[model samples]
Target: MTWSLIAKDVDGSIGVIVASKFFACGAVVPYVDAETAVATQAFCNPLWGTEGRLRLSVGEASTGVLTDFVRRDRGQAIRQAHMMDKYGEFAAHTGSECIDWAGHLLGVKHSVAGNMLAGPDVIEATSAAYLAGADLPFAARLIGAMQAGEAAGGDKRGRQAAGLVIHRGQPHAWLDLRVDDHADPLNELSRLWDVAQERFVHFANAMPDRARFSGTPTRHQIDEEIAMAEARRKAEGRGSRSHAVEFG
Candidate 1:
């Protein structure tokens, strides 16, 4: 089974996707918010996201359209999926023919999933994490939820890949972090999230002065800033960690 958390940024303008699997599993989820965001997935339905976005662009209410789509899927009995849109509207389906013990759980702006966990407690923990308003990063929040779920009763199959995506302001992605294979995917995802933040900081720093400050920065000023930051980094023993390092 699968669970996904899709949300807009705090201002209600971005889109995010975070999910967990019992193993190599991923969601067959789909979503759309014509005025805000659109996303979808299936065991193989990549076009769900694209088509949903198009529908939103043409002026459709995300919830109404998604509800209609799911209800129309005669194949709804074939997969386990969840979805959320920019408006905070959400939906999920667990096919009758899905693996035994498969199910999904939901909370405000969040959904939790597990296929072979001890019971429904795994998803309950994830929902609780979202509802409790934890202070962790998006990935950490997801993993925290997963961990709580696991503590309650995780997958009988154990862990595998995990993914996190967040988008705010821009109709596209801001965070697309993942751990494709791992003994502990949620933990790896947490490490990758740290690396993603550091990469963003470096990218921000390397921006052309016009991009960073909205005005040309003198080459001298740029050099001085770089030197100062490098000095600080070295002094703090944070040296030589390149952007290429794999946090996962």
Candidate 2:
């Protein structure tokens, strides 16, 4: 009923892009954090995300977390999950009892997984797109991958929700967009992502981060950052087909 792409961004961030036939896949599938990112689906277990993140935060290995989570679960054979550490090490699992066309792929530092998908092509296309978009922003790269997956044929059951959650070198999300119960969730997600570029990303960039605990920037300073961000967007032709457009 779902598929996802979990990867480490070029900027050392972790991101998750997920879509499903289920409503509010965002509320269940992807568990994103700066230090580690995980997605648990199939006969879904919501605890995997929260508990896995805590384990990763405490210095556990991604492979260990993924294996341990699945191993300890009584319903392991129906579960599907994958994870990546901030350092780019990663792992994936596809339960034996998952529905037909269910499987997963692991790239250099990323993994693509799906269950109840249209076919193997869905996961393949998704992995290919993400691997090919090495120059795009973390969020854009993910969106493109999901778009490719959708083009190949997404959830066999049909699509209703899609979500993108990214943690760009922060414990909190840099961008978290969801299209719940939409006729075309991934496309709707794309539109919301573009809207986020208008101001949200810059504001998120200006806020106090883990590295800087105090002395938050002034509103005027934030405005300056937003201006600079806009200028960078213009320079790189962001939202268009361009390359290495780094801001925020």
Candidate 3:
């Protein structure tokens, strides 16, 4: 019912994108932190979102985490998941009982997995788009990759919702957007990404960080930062993450 791409960038950013015929696909399917990324779908066990993340955070290897999850789950044959560690180690599981065309693929720093998809092209195009757009901002790369998957015929049933999450420094999400119900969730997500750069992304930048106990750089300070950041982006033809917004 869903497909997702989980990746960790060289800069220690972790991102996840999920699309599905199911409602609120993002809320349950993808999990990410500054250190690890995971997608759990195909008869998803929600516990993996929390448990798997916790396991990885505590220093468990991706392979070991997958092994532990599989050993404890009785319905492993119907479940699907893939994960990547901060060190770029990857692991995945695709159940035999899952729908046909359900599988996964791994790349330099990413993994693409889905079940109930239209065909192998869905993931193939997704993986290709992601690697091809290595120069894009983290959020752009993820959304564009998923869009390619959609163009290649995404969820076999249809599309209803989508989600993208990125984790950079803090324990909390660096960026998170979800389209719980929408006719074209992917485009809506792209629109939201555009909206985020307007103020939300810069606002998030002002929040308390590793050094500041109480988020400094108050209201007006944030406003100036936003304006200045935009000016800088315009000056250099850059956008998110100091790079131009170029989608594949």
Q: What TM-score would each prediction reach against the true structure?
A: 0.69, 0.88, 0.90
> Candidate 3 local accuracy as lDDT?
0.88
- Among these predictions, the greatest lDDT belongs to 3
What value does the lDDT take at residue 175 in candidate 1? Answer: 58
lDDT of 3 at 123: 98
**lDDT at 49, model 3:** 74
Q: Please, what are the lDDT tens digits per residue for candidate 1 over residues 137-174?
A: 45456556666666776665666766665543343444
Q: How far in Å is the alpha carbon of 213 misplaced in model 1?
A: 13
Compared with the true structure, model 3 gives a TM-score of 0.90
Ranking by TM-score: 3, 2, 1
Model 1: runs farther than 4 Å from truth?
Answer: 8-44, 56-59, 113-116, 201-248
Q: List candidate 3 stretches off by more than 4 Å.
A: 228-248
Judge candidate 1 at residue 118 and give its lDDT.
65
Candidates sorted on lDDT, descending: 3, 2, 1
Model 2 gets an lDDT of: 0.85
